[model samples]
Target: MTALAATSTPSQDLPSLIERAASMLSGAKTAAEVLEAREVAGLAYDVAKRAARLQRAKSAHDDLVAAAHRAQAHALEIEARAKRRLADEYDAAQARGEVAGHGGGRNFKVANGNVETTTADLGLRRDQIHEARQLRDAEAVDPGIVRRTLDERLEHGEEPSRAALRKMVVDAAMRGMRPQRRASRRNPLYVAPTPEQAAWRHVTGVFRAFAEWASDENLALARKGMREAGDTPFHDLDARAIAQGSAAFTTIKEWFDAR
Candidate 1:
């Protein structure tokens, strides 16, 4: 209460002495005003506590946001894995013939009833859009138009094979050389003819069949030839061995031509 010692004038003491004295005074005053100062300091401490808690909460929120992003990335990875697995399963199932059409040739209808196809399996998105245009245009024509147009276009061609001509004459009699007329013709007897006549007859029958088939525009001739080559008498013959045995007489054509 000595007027707080004139509050110590700045010029009254040396700088070091003044600093030391100021520290001693502050310590002494804090002890004397302990309760009052404690209340005020407590308020500041409370403010710091709240600020620290707010900082911690902000940090925790940032961590949660980061975790959410990581979870989202994981979900995308899982989705990609599922898509690849489904694609592989689809390919395996197709190989085993569980689905219809050529093994890898058709569009896929997914489990969700959505149509999706790989670029390799069918058209890409852009290609599908283009093909859709063709389909839309074709749908405008009659269903039978393509076949009818082809038949009419080939009507004047030379008569092809029996199997072929039959296709061309879609509505006509099944057999040509009318049945009654063929019956009256002189029939060749089973008795052996000259070798020249025998070979000629066989050759004539083959040529006639080929001509008729070609004229009729029958598309199955190549398949029929391959099928016949694999069956019965022709397949059993050692065509390969025969070719290897003689160089000058090599190959099916050479063997037949040499004879």
Candidate 2:
């Protein structure tokens, strides 16, 4: 009991000393124990702080990984948009090439599903108009033929310009037949007024003055009266007789009034 045990080496006794200290600190209650527990608690607090720092670092790493995934997704979307744009440009170029391959004359199918050449259609219409105009111009005959047809129509009560009439004329000409002279007929009149009688109304009072003067009577007034009578074809001889001074002015006036 009196002999003391030899102290163990510091390195060899470290684990045992730490174990005892931990137990003491765990059970500490008094002032000295509380002070020792405080130191132990401070060390434990430092350990907890280090553990919290590690946890926060791991959380930050997880957050960075999620952000990286989102960034990659955004990059993929950008790439997809660029690819679509490129495809659109390529399609547009291909369409342009196809359009260019066709010459200036592009083919179009009509509603009837038939293909027709535009130029040929226009030419056909032009030809139709030309033919119609030629037909009209060709049918326009000489005026001399029209005039003869009109005269024949009036004298014979014939419907002229008939093909039968044309053939008859042609046949007669071929046979050297002489066309007979058509007679001009006169209408009968019940009473034929003398020229001096017809012109009596046309005689001027100025001519009466000339007749009263005898030789001094106005020749000008007599000539004017004759002109007035001659203006009308319905009376003739009486006007000339009055102008020549063959009929008495009073007789001419009476004949004119009677008419």
Candidate 3:
């Protein structure tokens, strides 16, 4: 036997060993060879069971991580919304002189033992929002580090299954969570077409005009010509195809006009 076959653990080479044992059983003529094959096959079964248990453990860990992340994000969102609502309420109270200082301007007293003035309550809410945001941003898993670790594991002859490899790649490509920015309170405005959009519109408009001017027979011919050029109505043609189609339609129109 080679060094690899000698050093390989049953878990790592279970499938190959199983196949070899099956082959040996098929070729066995003596009782001793047949008994050896049976022992190897039984060992392969144990290795397979161990591999499955490891896979299940890995899957459970991943599911727990995913659930933790989702819960963190949901808590952050709720905290942010609560903070905004509290700020709005504080501003409204101040505007109506319900939360003003006892003597004059902005000073206010704490109300109940557990609660305070609107300003102080708002401040507390803001602090809570900041803490929650930080907690949400703190990720336990570093995808880049995970990818490197995966590579090192594979290099050491610890082979991860295909599903595990896919998960590792996906995790490495995922971006870290951060606090979402509040949407700007700006009025919507109409925007003009971009230069690329304008050019494409011009090309398509030329084709449309030709289609409108062409006779029925010529219009049918134009459709056939575009189809022959590999253009499909269900999909938008590329710029080159658009230019070619426009030129073809224009020629067809001119031919019908001359007639």
Quick one: best TM-score, which candidate?
3
Quote the positional error of residue 201 for candidate 1 in Å: 69
Q: RMSDs, each prediction?
A: 42.9, 64.1, 26.8
**Model 2, residue 112: displacement in angstroms?**
45
Off by over 4 Å in 1: 1-61, 97-105, 109-259
What lDDT does candidate 1 reach at residue 116?
51
Task: Assess every candidate by TM-score.
Answer: 0.18, 0.16, 0.22
lDDT of each residue in 80-195, candidate 1, tens digit only: 22222333444454565544434345544433335554435432243333322222222122222222333443343321122332343332323231112123345544344565
Ranking of all predicted structures according to TM-score, beginning with the best and ending with the worst? 3, 1, 2
Please write out the lDDT profile of model 3 over residues 85-112, one tens digit for every residue: 3334444445666566231245223334
Which consecutive 10 residues in model 2 have the weakest lDDT in total? 1-10
TM-score of 1: 0.18
For model 2, which pairs clash?
195-237, 195-238, 195-239, 196-238, 210-217
Query: For residues 81-191, could you state the per-residue lDDT of candidate 2 as single tens digits?
Result: 222232232234335452122222322122233543232321223343333222222212111232344345434533222243345435544554432223323534344
Question: Candidate 1 clashing pairs?
Answer: 160-212, 160-213, 161-212, 161-213
User: Model 3 — TM-score against the truth?
Assistant: 0.22
lDDT of 3 at 67: 28
- lDDT scores in order: 0.35, 0.35, 0.42
Off by over 4 Å in 3: 1-60, 100-118, 121-259
Mind sharing the TM-score for model 2?
0.16
**Positional deviation of residue 23's Cα in model 1 after best superposition, in angstroms:** 71
